[model samples]
Each structure stands twice: as C-alpha cells, then as structure tokens.
Target: MSDRWRTLRRRIITPDVSETRLDVRGFHVKNQVARDILETVGKSFLAGYAIAAEAKDQSIAERRIDALQPRFRGFAYEGAAMAYAVIDGLSLWRRDNSPRFLAGPGDRHIYMAYVGIGWAMARVPRFRWQRLVLPDPTLRWLALDGYGFHQAYFKTARYVYDQYRDPSFTWHGGGPQSYVQRAIDQGIGRAMWFVYGTDAVRVADAIDGFDPERHQDLYSGAGLAATYAGGADEAELQTFWQRAGEHRPFVAQASAFAAEARIRAGLLVPHTEVATRVFCGMTATAAATLAETTRPDGPDGDQLPAYEIWRQQVAREFVAIGRN
Candidate 1:
C-alpha cells in the first residue's frame, strides 16, 4: 500500500522524461490525503493556541497547561517549547493517520510555516514576540517568499536554540530537552531547506530520511543518547522515554489532524498548479475542521470568518506564485 501511494505521488508530482516538470497547474484531485493533514493539524494547533492565549496571565496559561497535563504529560515545556511541540504533535498525528505519499499542500504549508517561523525568529523581533504570544498568526503574510524560505529545517532549529534560552529547560537529570529538541528541529529544518533551496529529488531524499515514521524514533533516541549517554546504562534510555512519553501522543494526534485538514481545504488537490494550493490547503482544512468540531460558542466558531478571509488571501498568493 505504501509503495502504491509512493508511486502515485511520484506520478502526480513528477513530470515524464519528455517533460521538465509536472505542470502542477491542473492535475486531478483523486484523494483526500492533503486535506486531512491540513484539517487535523490546523485544529490541534488552534486548540493549543487558544488554550495558550486564554492563559495569557502566565499563571493562567500555566494552570491550563497543568489542567491539560494528563493529556500532554511528558510534553511540558515553557514558551516556545510548548508552541513548537504543538506544531510537532500536529505533524506526527497526520503521519500516523494517513497514507504517506499524499502529503501535498499540507506538507508544503508545514514547510512554509517552519520557514516563516524561522525567518521571523531569525529576523523580525515583532514576529518572534507575536509567535510567542499568539503562536498561529491569521495574517497570510506569515508565509515567506522563496528566497527567505531557503533556510533548512536544522537552520531553524539552531535559530530556536540561539533565540530562546532557559538554563533549566532540561530533561529528568539527563540534560536539556532543548538539546534533543534542537536536533529534531534542525533535522526538519534541514529537510525543508533541501525541499525549497534545492530540487525535488533532494526534497525526496530529505523527506525519506526525516520522515516521521522512520526518523521519529531515531531522532528521539539520538536526543536521549546525546543527553544521557555519559555514564548511564540502559536505565537512562528508559528514563528518557518516560519523560518524553507525554509529547509522543501529542505529536501523533497533531499529525493526524494536519492530514485531515489538508484534505478538507482543497489545497491538497491532485495536480493543480495553483501556487496558493499550499496556503489554501492549510486554511481550508482549518476552517472545515473548526466548523464541524468546534461549538458555535467556541473560539473555533469565532475564527471561521477569519479562516475564510485568510483563504481568499491565500488564493491571491497562489496567483502571485503562479505569476512568478
């Protein structure tokens, strides 16, 4: 099944030998994989952000995190840590649920988001502060252009470490969880860099290596080894896993949500060459999920209009990408 999906994706994404590239302008939209990724991840991220926002009183946010502690147990962290975890969680959830080949636009959005976040963290102070405050920005400007998006996943990881520092943000006597987080972050960052900075073949390689299924455990283990391998035995690995367990579920759930969202958004269409496919994929997914799952009285309901507004903006962006 996985192989079939891969072949399909390749056929959809890659042009024939006679052609230079797939004319992504108007391909078919056979499956719903992309929509699924967007919807699911968008919902989870929004939920986390809302919780974080309402807890703006710091003490309030801490309490909310505490109240949600059982569900997010091993995943506790401060400030940006929490934000990034939410994003990672969404990615994992999508992967766990869907066919691997149909990442499409939702995957693009994640890459874009990471690039934008990295750029904001690396360049803009207001953007960084805004991210720390709100996490997910409604404004479509959050998606950076190609040049700005060139930075790899690991580059962003390094930036995260450089920008934010907590002397106490370590694991259970092992070392700083940030260290492990940094590696995973960097790995993903590098993967994105390959995707945007280079060619599709490189992107494929990075995706293969850093894929959630194959690399998640390896990345986790590498982090543990880095933080606790000094003088410890097998106990260290077990302890590391115990501490990180809380985050595992969050990651899985969030990834699933992301996949679902993409499908609903229509941005995950088969061969559409519309540049905004990525943005539409994300916003559409978020909007659809919010409409279905969020109560009329909930924040999701309130954000529906906002999502629509953003969708239009994304459409414009797609036109712009196509023009260029």
Candidate 2:
C-alpha cells in the first residue's frame, strides 16, 4: 500500500479522539484535578499513537515522545506501544517493530508499553492476537492489565457496574485461564480509580462491591493507579489506605510497583512521592527498592507465575511492616 493509503487505513482504524472526552464517555468528574488527570492521560496516549502511526522510524517517534513533559511521557509511550503493536498485528508487511521499540526506547516505559500491547489486543481481532509482540513472560501480563483498563474505561457499565468477567479469556491457550481473569480484574480495579474521579473512598467502595476473591487484585490495581497517576492528596491517600483495611498490603505492593515504574523512567513526580509516603510510609525510591528487592529471580518459579510471586512478596513486606 502507498504511504497515503497506510495513513488513511490507520485513520479509519484508530478510535476518534473525541471518544476520550468526559462527556462523550460519560465518565464521572470528581473535580478539575480528576478531569485534568484523565483528560491528560487520554491526550498523551493519542499523541503517542499518532506519532507511532506517522513517524518514519522508531528514533523519530522516540524523539517526539521525549519532547513530551515527564509527567505524561510514559502515557504517550503507552500509546506509541499500542500503535506499534497494532501495526505489527494488522500489517504483515511491517517488521516486528513493537519488540524493537520495547527493547530500545520503550524499555524505560516497559510497564506502559506492555499495557499498550494490551490495548492493541483489544483493537485487533482474536485471530491476529498471536502476531502482536509481547516480549516479557512475566511483565506480559500487564498487557491484560491494559486490556482490562481499556474495557473498563470504555465500557464502564458492563465492566464496572455489572461486574463482568470474560469466561472465555485465555492466554494463547496456555496456563489456567482463571489467572488471566485475575490480571484483567486488576486492570478493572485500576480503571475504577479514574472512573470514580480519584475519590479514594469511591474507588475503595467500588472495589468492595466486587467479589471478595477479587478484592486483593483490585486493591493492587487501584493502588498502582492512585500512586502512579496521583489525583488525590495526602489526606485522600490516607483515607484510601484506611479503607483498604485487609487489603492494605496489596495496596502497598501497588505503591511499590508504581514507584518503581516512575523511578525507572526518571519521571518521579511530586504527587507520586506523596502517594508513596501515604501508601507505603516511605519515599518513592525506598518503595521502588522494596519492590525490586522482593521480586522473584525469574518470571516463573515454584509452580506459580513469578509475577504473582513477586507481587505477593511485596505485599508480605508490607504486612511485615506492621500494616497488616
């Protein structure tokens, strides 16, 4: 296809930017801060997607994304990762670009990049799913997390209100599919933070409304969202922690994860710092270090996926800290 045709094809396939608007999506707006946070995320994501769709090379896209402010840069990377994954999945002609990007410029934004792949998975048909690049065995689960976030954010009523779970979800027909649902629920839990307008109590209440078996993962997702996106103040974070109750360890684990993501990208913002303090009772660096220290040596071990083991270990650290 001609370059113009490719551009047109992408345009036809990509969702409209207007779909991200609060009014268009019918998402709640707790206040200006909440509105700004969600809108910025949408805008950055689209911006990255556009760059990836149009740029002649990965370096060009990386340079453009680098121009974005630190606070939103990772979100743009997420969008770029999504676009590349979509390109790879839909166009057999394209090289395996997503993996290259992930191995290079997208490395710092690895978490967001995996989530981006999940977004691409959501857009592409199931038959083409195998074509998309998901390099990390452990972190690859974040793609499902992204998939969950995309569904909950876009189809809130069915996902959030009705508490839906896809019984047919399978990870390329490997492993127990129930684990896939758990990863997705984590993403849904993350989206709840944004859907409720970053109101800590509302986010907590939404998690509470879910099945008890799902609460720990939900709290993990919400905690990651709250700490990473940071729409709440210290007092609000304290409220969220208090409400988490039995799930406090999970939430703290999320804080550690969020801290590591931000710190790894050199995009640690003040809001993240405040959130880490409230959620983990430590600096963001310390929380990130804790996450690293607790991570399993490999991606799979001891019969359980290494990813879950890593998260469980982090949560145990929090429990050991007397927060249990």
Candidate 3:
C-alpha cells in the first residue's frame, strides 16, 4: 500500500497506539491545526465504518451513529465529512449489501456529509494544493475546490491589483469560458455555501457584494452550493430558487440533485418524501429505485457509478422541467 494509505489505515484502525507523523505526498502539511483536523476526519471515518460494519440492520446503524458524536465532537463540519468517508468505505466493503441507515436522505447523516465536504474545502491549506490526491475519501472531495480556489484567488488577486494600481479603475467582468472555469467557480461557491451552513439566506447575505452580472460564474457557483447543501427547508428552497433569478433552473437542478442524494441516503420515507418532491420534483419512488438499483445486488450493481449517471439524468430533467 502507498505510505499515505498505510498511515491513514494505521491511524484509523489503531489511533491511540499510532503516533506517527502525518506525511501526505506533495503536501507541506506541517501545521498542527491542519493535522489535527485531518486526524479528526480519519477518526470520524473509522467510527462510521466500524458502526455500519457491525450493525445488524439499518435501524441498528442509525442508533449506533449517536455514539459516534463524542468521538467526532468539537469539529462538526469536518466530522461530518469523516462520517461520509466511513459511509463510502462501508458501501465499498459491503459492496451490494450496504446498510440502509447509511443509505438515503431519510437518514440525517447524508446532509451532514455534504456539509462536511464544504467545510473541509473551505479550510484547506494553500500549501496542499499539489497533493490534492491525499489518500482519504473526504480529502478527495475537498480537493475538488482547488479548481475554484485557483480562479477565485487569482481573479480576486487581479481585482485587488487593479484597485491598488489605479484608484479610479473600474472592475472588469468575465464569465466562465470553459468547463474548468465553471468547475472552479462552482467549487468556490460550494466552499462558501458550506462555510455559511448551507443557509440560502446566509449564502445570499454573504455573497451580496458579488455582482451577478460581472461574476456570473460565482453566482452559479453559489446557487449550486446552496442547492446541494440544502441548509434550508422546502419553503426556503422555493424562496432561494426564486432568489437565483437568472440562475433559477441551475439552482433547481442542484436542489434536484440534493433530493436525489437524500433519496439515495434513504430519507425518502412515505411521510417525509413530500418535502424533497416539492424541493426538486424528484419523487420518493424514483429516488428509492435509483438507490436500490445502484446497490451491489441491484441491477446496475455499483452505487458510485450509478449515482453519477442518475444525477446527470435528474439534473437534465430538472433543467428541462423548469422552475415552475
């Protein structure tokens, strides 16, 4: 195994006994604070993986998650990401027979995972940009923000340079000209979204300084972030959906994806399905079927690949369906 992987394995499997130095390749991660956060993430992963692995059923797993809180205490956002890694690991180890508690949106942990990913990215040390491939599920997700951070940092830097170079200078605006640019912007917005606790109003409040006309990509980025993190209720989602204005369809599509994630997470019980249905037009049945089919025993037999395919299709559907 790669040294990084071995290090993580040792840390997660036997944390108390393992006091080895953290060595992520290409990353100058010497900061104690950053290392502690990373270690917390690892511990969080182990907690989820072990619980899911041992549970008799979904109910048991759900009940077991409560005990993991103290282990992940103090760092809510990072802990959530770590928990997700555990779920992902559980999904991988069990393959076809993944537990239901770790399954869908009906479970509360799914939303926590998305939030955790956002928090991790926001706190990523600039030095670790090159080693975005650190051997951890949560870090892999966090690495996605590098694209956005590159654009945000440079664009803002240029903006700062211009303002300082010439007091009378006006801001020059640009839109994303390529997929990478769009991804970068989206990543940035997602990070901000997490930092703001996925609250649409809070995110809106935070990005109010951004000009929608000039920073179109960031606007879209914020929309995607809010939609996915879904820190708000259905009524709030509707309000935020309308708040997106020009980016409404994109935001709606993101909400649809969140709904899909929730469904896959197994949160689509009969009484609770309406909330997501209203939020994204994705019904419980569709979500549940997709969740089932993506499982190892399901027709497709692989959750990760199946989920991406479903997300794309659902996104297209939401866009075509329009915000109405």
Candidate 4:
C-alpha cells in the first residue's frame, strides 16, 4: 500500500539544514575539518531521512542510500530508519512500513536502525510509542541511546551543560530499570564527541564533568561516535585512547561495536580501521569478529540484558588483553 500524504508528512518530519550546524547548535568548533565532519553527518542524516520520507518504496530508498559513500552511508541509513520508525509510529492511516525496511536493506544497519527508532521516539509522542516497531528486546535499549543522542545533540545546554536526567523517561524492560539511564548516558556521551568538535581533550573533559559512575558508559558512547563518525586523525584517536584511562576497556568495546556496525553496513572506512587499531589493538575486521563471537545468544537475561552482557564480555576481553 502507498503511504498517504507522503509529501505533507515529509515536510512535517524533515528538520532544517541549518539546525545541525555547529554555530546554530552553539557547540564547539575545533577547526574546519571537525566542522565538516559534524555537518556532513547532519547532511547525510537529512538526506537519508528524505529518502525514506519521500520515496515511494523501500527499494527506491535502498538504491539511493547505497549510492552514498562508505563513511557517510551508514548515517544515511540511520536517518532513513529514523524516518521509517516515525512513519510507522505516526502514520496510523496505514499499516506498519518499518518492518519492510528493517527486515530488508535495514537488516545490515540494524544497530543504526534501532538508534534511528530512538530518534523517532524523541519526535513521536509517548502515547503513540506502542505503535513503534521495537520487536528485539535485547537491542531495544538502543532506541534510548538514539533518544539520548537526540536530546543531548539538540538540547545541549540542558543535557550536556546541566547533565540533566529525565526522571520521567518511561521505557523499561522486564528486568531492572536502572540500566535505562546508563543506556541513555551512552548516547549523551556519543553526542558529546560531536558537541566537543572531535577534540580529544575537550571530549575527555566533558566526560569527566559527568558523574563518576557514568564515566564508563559515557566513554563507550563517545568511543563509538569517535570511531564511526571519524573526524580525528590517528594521533587524536590515540590521544582519546590514552585519555580513557580505566575506561579504556569500554572504549575498546564500543570501538568494536562501531567496527561491526560499519562492516555489516558495508561502510567500513580507513578511519574506522585506525580507530579500531588504537582502541582494540587490532584491525576493524578483527575487532568486529570479536564483537560477533562474544555476542551472547538468547533472549534478555533475568538481571542484565543480552546487549549489556555482550558489551561486558567484549570489555572484559579488552581489559584482559591490555589495551594500548
């Protein structure tokens, strides 16, 4: 079935281009290179969103998304997934279309697609949340990561400056709900990388400003963003690796996660390889393999979800290996 009022919905959903600009967001601007990295991600996200919001079918959107270069292509998929989630969540006028995208072209970018669902959560109201397609219990927390990233990126002053936690956040699994904030903090940490303009010192300082308990998760998020988005050079990545200190294992774990995301999406680039080397002491391929092999098989656990268990496994392995 064709999506109704596709044009009108597209106009309503897509954000303004200027809004993602550093100056518009009043975020740090380390240099032109950093500025480009941040802006390119924004542009790529918008492009992907538009592809989904306006395209007639999933196949059309896939073709357009595949045309993008490796580094930015995954971001576009992320944006497209966000659009699909939004469409499915808000478009009660029709049947769910998100599954089509998620099961097909989006399968490879599943990590990003979940994050994209989180982006939809940020835009879609709580009442409509039930309609969203979040079948995978283990990876569902990633939607919060996307929501956290969205809030921290857009509401920088409230989230980043004040370090505000939304006591009202309602999403929780059958197990302990305490991990909710930790998952969100990871997204906030990811946003901080862009907020700090990819400056290793500034990013580390921002992480330090957070509550001590949140440092590890924050480092994990920032590590993923740094590796995936890739504005920093080899030295900068090494600097970030050193700055992680005791949290290096989480950073290493997250770097591996990023590697797997890129590799699965067929978007792995040299910068990702370099970042993986610095953090995981291995190539992106090896790091991704570790992430895959270590991933726990089964449903959500009684205490910790499978996602957290997987992350812990990878982190422990890095700690044991002596990250450099």
What's the count of clashing pairs in each model shown?
48, 0, 12, 0
Q: Candidate 1 residues 206-237, lDDT tens each?
A: 33344354333232222221221111122432
Tens digit of lDDT per residue, candidate 3, span 212-324? 44234444455544443333456765665555566554554444444454454443333234434654466655534543343332222133323233434544555666644
| Residue range with the least summed lDDT across 10 consecutive positions in model 1 | 96-105
Q: Could you estimate the TM-score for every candidate?
A: 0.24, 0.95, 0.43, 0.96
Instruction: Tell me the TM-score of model 2.
Output: 0.95
Q: Say which candidate scores most in TM-score.
A: 4
lDDT string for model 2 (1-324, tens) is 567875775587667888767777777788997888888888889989988887778898899999998988999999999998988888868658898999998999899999899998889889999888776777878998999999999999999999998777668824445478888988999989888888888888888999999998998899999988878988999999999999899899988999999999999999999988888988999999999887777656545676788889988888888866
In candidate 4, position 170 carries an lDDT of 84
lDDT of 4 by residue, 58-114 (tens): 899999999987789898999999999888778757647777888898999999999
> Local distance difference test, per candidate?
0.29, 0.87, 0.41, 0.89
- Backbone clash pairs for candidate 2 read none
Output the lDDT of residue 270, model 4: 93
lDDT of 3 at 260: 51
Between 1 and 2, whose TM-score is larger? 2
TM-score of 4: 0.96
